[model samples]
Target: MSERIPVFKPYIGVDTAKAAVDALDLGWLGMGSYVRDFEARLGSVLGVEGERVVAVNTGTSALHLAMLSLGIGPGDEVITPSFNNIGDFQAIRQAGAEPVFCDIDEETLGIDVEKAEALISPRTKALIGMDYAGIPCRLDALQEMAARHQLKVIHDAAHALGSRLHGRSMAAYGDITIFSFDPVKIITSIDGGALVVETATQVEALHRYRLLGMDQSARRMYTNERAWTYDVADRGFRYHLANLHASIGLSQLELLSAFIETRRDACRRYAALLAGVEGLRLPATDFTDVAPFIYYVRIAGGRRDDVIRSLSEAGIDTGIHWIPGHNFTLLKTCRRGDLSVTERVGREILTMPLHSFMPAST
Candidate 1:
């Protein structure tokens, strides 16, 4: 490597800070017009005609809205991968549903479609497929399974803002797709996320659910602004992003194409650099339109910790993307059956720094 790398780097600029500054000076720091504009702009990126996308404060809220809108409440089981971030689990629980754990396949580092099948029960309501490190999930296969099981599909696209599969965005396939705009993503909205949903019913439900569940429309209020006469139709939260976050998001979204290209180039270079390294595995590319969001390499022979320690000592901080969600103390009691592969893969995986900020080197 030409230069030292950190665990993660946020792709950002002065323009983003200026946008937030302008919002601060204005005084209206609540969610309003900016969020709507961001939503409209983001919806356009879906590459799907008439795609209805909604922007929320965080990715968690987006998933929560997806579950809530689908009426997935207590006793409903949402089959999900235990190989990635646990944010989706909280969203499921918040929607009063249980998140059923499914193991990942070592070959693709994605949820084993067959393993997912075994976990399905009569109470299964939905399936949330996580696009681990920008690799688009096998949506076609998963969708087929979802349809057969009568379950809606939600995509945790937190690391897949600009990722694609077969020229289609992940959001284009899932019933509800959530994109996180956190600092370390390909693009940064400072701190924000968007939920690409379908149908007016789902959009309206998301809007209300994120904005206090209040009928704040002027038509429903005696005054020009929202009045005290409001109803909490569903369990809602103040998950609406401020104008500042939206402003920054707008700038970042415009720069997404370039960022994505850079990330792809980096992944190709990384894969080539370590092409013949033994005891290491490069990411699989079953999907043609693969768009990488992280620089991860799986260390075989259980030397993942050694690599991380070595990288850290060399000023190249590395990270393990996640631990199995079921391993968490909170969910330990709920874990059923054996999860050996999921347990081992959880430790063997390591992520190197990847973003658009680093200078291109030959």
Candidate 2:
């Protein structure tokens, strides 16, 4: 009999279901002890203090709140890679800032600092970077670039939960770091994200930002007290992560190291098995310290469509990581320059089936 494979699957088991039920039975389903515990464990993983991490319900919300707390507004720009999910650009536009699409290094497919330097204008307030598939972004170069420009670094680490660079977790490399726990990602809290803000001022701002600009008053209400006082320092959103979601996160965190190793082993095995496959160029990965989020390969000579058709016919589901933000309709009216690499790579990238599902073959 022939075996089937899945594109993306998480390792949520019986324990996860039990934990969720228990949390819900407690009747405190909002951001409470479970959320706090998850944040604490997550902070420990990032090598940060417990107070540094603020858990939210989605990665986009994390980015939106981070931008609000970072004080990014209209007329400001945040430099990011042109080849990325539209959501990144959407978050920038949502924050009332312009996302300056920068070119990426072809080999690692990460944001290129040199191109970012050229795009830097007086209004460039922050640098947002993504790992592109659990591979750490060129942090040393990116940090230097942000330092020279005096701009803050906010990492969109949706695909880099278990990744590190130069022996340091990716979270430590940015002034602000955001991670996603969506079902398809490295781990899932069903759907969650977190913002890491180390400073007191940023934390205070973030508190208000996530709870709809009602920082202190909201906290008092939760404690059954009437603090009929509030101020909207700035426009914010309802971005808090629920306690039930955090319970699932806590259960998953207990198994992240093992989860990372499983992904690494799968990636290595896939590389070994397909190394001899002709006409396919595997993604360039940083094996030193990174998790394998998704295994992508390039199909050369215009065979991408053909290869995909063949795979789909065999019941295999696949996907493209992104469509190159520079090519989007939103940027069509803007004066966008040549992002030749992004335009070229967008057509060739294809993520394969390598999640934590498919049973081992004999």
Candidate 3:
């Protein structure tokens, strides 16, 4: 059998291993200096104030915290694209809010702003816009609509950490942005995420929320110290990112630029190679402005499953980025607008193997 090609792989190496070992050797593993360092470095990369960035255990935690910080609760509703990951929907539910499903634009595979606007009602409190496959959503429009309607916006940038919009980092534009550093993401901390907000007050709330509502100062924690005299005032979770994972994240952060460049090159190659193939629709962008996560193609004529089987038999793995939130039984009864584009795209989208520093032969 030929060597199997994975749909996603972390670019781990000796340096990453050494970083983990060194972090272990430090004897301070939980939410310590390394986590602080990771958040600082990530903030610098995103051109945001370090204090505004809060590290969490996973992308979903970041979403949940963002929802909590924004005061979304049982009576509130958050508009989100149904053609999105389950994490986003669960996060909304975790905050005791209902997720109002919206449609996506066929071009960007992002929320259709017009459709989303129509879904807004008196109960609507927020909107969650995610970047599909590292392609940015219509952020400016989303922000404008949110402001006009007096609603908060959460930018689910799980797949777009290094992606840019109009030459600015996606983090720079959104009201509140969350990034995933999962094993299969553009960068990995094994399993971690970060939230970037606009104010120190918001940061303080996230800090308390991520660390079990403790009023302990993060400054002391960064030096690997803890205060037993802290107070807990509100609901919180054990969502803090540990030093072990943050150490890996810091190492991975050092190579993000290179990883993004190589991934973009691979995506360009895929687009070029797959062009003119029958019964397929490729991504619309040229990938210059995007970080290029998983390169996907829409297989027509109900042949997506057949193509997946063929690829698996050839020792090449493929993936379905998502199954669409509305199709799930839990979300089936959620309020929604026209999901025509989402339902069609959900059935057709197929992600190909993509990784950093991919060899030419791959």
Better of 2 and 3 by lDDT: 3
115-215, model 2: which lDDT tens digit per residue? Answer: 77888889999988888888777878898989988998988888998788878887888888999999888789999999988797787777777777775
TM-scores of the candidates in the order shown: 0.92, 0.93, 0.99
How many angstroms is residue 126 displaced in model 2 relative to the true structure, after the best TM-score fit? 1.6
| Candidates ranked by TM-score | 3, 2, 1
Q: Give the alpha carbon lDDT tens digit for every residue of 1-362 in model 1.
A: 45677767776578777777876786656675566667778877777433377777877777788888888999999888877677888988988899888887776577777878888889999988888888876778888999998888887888777677777777777787888887777777777878777687777777778777876652232121345667777666888787788878888888888777777777777887888999988788632365567878888898887888887778787777888888898776556555677887787788877777455662
lDDT, each prediction: 0.76, 0.81, 0.92
For residues 194-296, what per-residue lDDT tens digits would candidate 3 score against the true structure?
9999888999889899899998998899999999898899888999999999999999999999999999999999988999999999999998889988899
The ten-residue window of minimal lDDT in model 2 covers: 217-226
Ranking by lDDT: 3, 2, 1
Model 3 CA lDDT for position 355: 96
Model 1: residues >4 Å from true position, as ranges? Answer: 1-4, 48-51, 218-229, 286-288
Worst 10 residues of 3 by lDDT: 333-342
In model 2, pairs of residues that clash are none
What number of clashing residue pairs does each candidate have, in the order they appear? 0, 0, 0
The model with the greater lDDT, 1 or 3, is 3
Better of 1 and 2 by lDDT: 2
